[model samples]
Target: MVNSTQVSYFTLTAYFDTGRLKHLYFLVVLTLYILIISSNVLLIVVISVNRSLHEPMYMFLCSLFVNELYGSSGLFPFLLIQILSDVHTVSAPLCFLQVFCLHSYGGVEFFTLAIMSYDRYLAICYPLHYNIRMTSNKIAVLTAVLWVYPFLSNVFLVFVLTVPLQLCGNLINKVYCDNYYIVKLACSDTTVNNICGLVKMFTVILGLIVLIIYTYIRILKVCFSGSKQTRQKVFSTCTPHLASLLNFSFGAFFEIVQSRFNLSRLPNMLRIFLSLYWLTCQPLVNPVLYGLKMSKIRNACKDLLFGRKIYL
Candidate 1:
């Protein structure tokens, strides 16, 4: 407390301080984590093994599910330890790693969702030229970009921008490691970091938002002007994407807004819920939405489980 020095560990203050409910919280979180991992892994396996489901759309879905698992793994294990341990602190390096994984998870989700929307656009609006426009090589390249670009972006943010900062405090008033929270705790001026982060956020997040909106608009127009079969096909494929998008967007909006401002009046439990909703909800929601809502994926999963043609 006498002088400022490099901080080694940060205390997470967003968790419930009550010791009585720790076991209950741990059990709930563990069950949810298990469910998330099982569902995402199952979908990934079904998508990977079923040759008929090896199309561009399913491939992207597989990648998305894997990212969900990656993101959840980054936080859940640490969270379980925290729940059981007497202290709730993370070392600086591990905190930054969590930041990178979770932020990259959000970025990759948006980018992948954008790509999925574009795929839907091509398939629905240009049925004849869809195969040519969305070839295997092209989809593979796009998928690589979706995974790589977000990671590189976050690497720069964490290493180049964040590592240099001199932090005044080591207590983060949130359940997870976040770039914004780290910046806020910096002792020196973070004008450059703020500006760079804002620009990157806009370019990646807002750009994807615009792309999704445009693609959906075009898809709606095409569906409106197409035949019954065409409309049904579009709805069947597009509904799941829209649901996932809206679910993620709602959680992200709350987190972003809450992070940017000092929401001191809000209850602690509510704050924690807002901050973690995306990480908790999207990972569990996507597999269920896609598996149950999409006939092809559902039937393929049934066939895989029963070892027989369920509907074909």
Candidate 2:
């Protein structure tokens, strides 16, 4: 049996060179974190308090906002501390914890988006049976499954593969502790780990992508056959979802490129930005897109902020 040794801490790359400008970088990041939290929380509260807003679509949208907050929290606090401190080191347990949260964040995000698409498809295509099909109990169960599946999947990955490995290095090249980066440090063979990771990715990520596309195709066909009003409604509801999918897909694409290819000649800051664009942009973009583009949510936010009720 191989004796396993543990890494106590990992050194993360700071976003910028250590200089007077570091303070400026810290302030900007802190501001963005604050904005992400505030906006997501605001959307959650609006959805929760307004009785009219408590429908299947809004429920899934709330889950999406909460997942964004969950994922962002995993990174922003750790990032904030790194920005302020002279050394960018994170404890091993904390690193693992961040990996779990961020990974689950991505899994839950795709699943939630898939569910949202299904909810829309049912609402538009089967209006007469929508309520019968998407009951509150059913919605709650799906939301629970979306959150639980990723958490448990990551748990298996971290425990079975990551925990037993003997680490050969402690210096993570990125600003956060990524699972692949941690796996890279292992002295033992990672073939099993790689295979398991790919399977999980296929099930959680690619599977959801396929489901979302199928649901959208059905919804589009229905929309094309319906009246002008039906088409307008479908467009209003789906535009935000599609925009979010494209935005997040681009971010995921950047990370995949960085991992699979050599772009080391690129500036460190640029590479770092590309790696983290999804985490930075999604939480901020989701609430903004939904709040501004969806009339009901927009009116609700305005009513909450301005104390003027606008009926939908």
Candidate 3:
């Protein structure tokens, strides 16, 4: 149990006590990470080189690939190191930085998805104007916001880390450093931190939900007014975006629930697995979902794998 009154820094270590299970876990996670890196990098390269795919949708897909790459990089490398070394202990400052990186990337990714949805709405609803509206300047501005907003949010979050937290037990139940979990161990009052976190969560997740839903509704309205062929084409184009959106939504929802709810009644192993569902499983699934569902991405990947020249 972690208490808030201890003086010395506590080191929390995570390990798979089950020998075979440990090996399996490492193998599985390593394999998934490799797939994630390869697929997303392939997507990025394909988009850059394939002139036919240099449109708004593929451009947004490229952005998503970039986000996933950074997000996974922020997460898995440290996890891989810890798993291999059989050590889970992290210093207080290090833990704080980890939390900052996780949240920052997450917030940015959420915002980028929202932007992508709006892009789709424009393309489907006002095809004549989409190219104009989603011009290089506009995309640049949105991309800049995606990069800046998260950094600012993390800067604000760092204030919460300054509060003296007594670390009695250093063991973090989850695979990675979570902000709420770390905050719970702080000896100082964390009302402000909690409030800030809630604000950040609502600002990113709730805001994106509203924006995405609005865009989809508008898209449906436009599709309904179009010819059958047009409607089918629109639906086909939106399918990949919808799949990506659902994956992100489900992953984020459970993560928020797990962090808020006290699962003290459950066994530690179960709790850890539940947490890993979001942190590990969800991220690993994103690139796969995109690659499998998006025909454009699929073709791009084929060209990449087969050593065909990618024309931009």
Winning model by TM-score: 1
Please state the error at residue 45 of candidate 3 in Å.
0.9
- Clash counts for all predictions: 0, 0, 4
- Alpha-carbon shift of residue 146 in model 3 (angstroms): 1.1
How many angstroms is residue 151 displaced in model 2 relative to the true structure, after the best TM-score fit? 0.5
TM-score of 1: 0.95
Winner of 1 and 2 under lDDT: 1
Please provide, for model 1 over 37-151, each residue's C-alpha lDDT reduced to its tens digit, 9 standing for 90 to 100. Answer: 9999989988888788889999999999999999999889988988887888999889988999998998899888899999999998898999999998999899999999999
Q: Quantify all predictions' global Cα lDDT against the true fold.
A: 0.88, 0.86, 0.75
Residue-level lDDT tens digits of model 2 in 13-42: 535566887788889999999999999999
Between candidates 2 and 3, the one scoring higher on lDDT is 2
Which lDDT tens digits does candidate 3 get at residues 41-106?
A: 877888898898988778777887888788788788877777766556766666667777787877
Sliding window of 10 residues with minimal summed lDDT for model 3 = 1-10
Better of 1 and 3 by TM-score: 1
Q: What lDDT would candidate 1 get against the real structure?
A: 0.88
Give residue 89's lDDT in candidate 3 (0 to 100).
73
Sort every candidate by TM-score, greatest first: 1, 2, 3
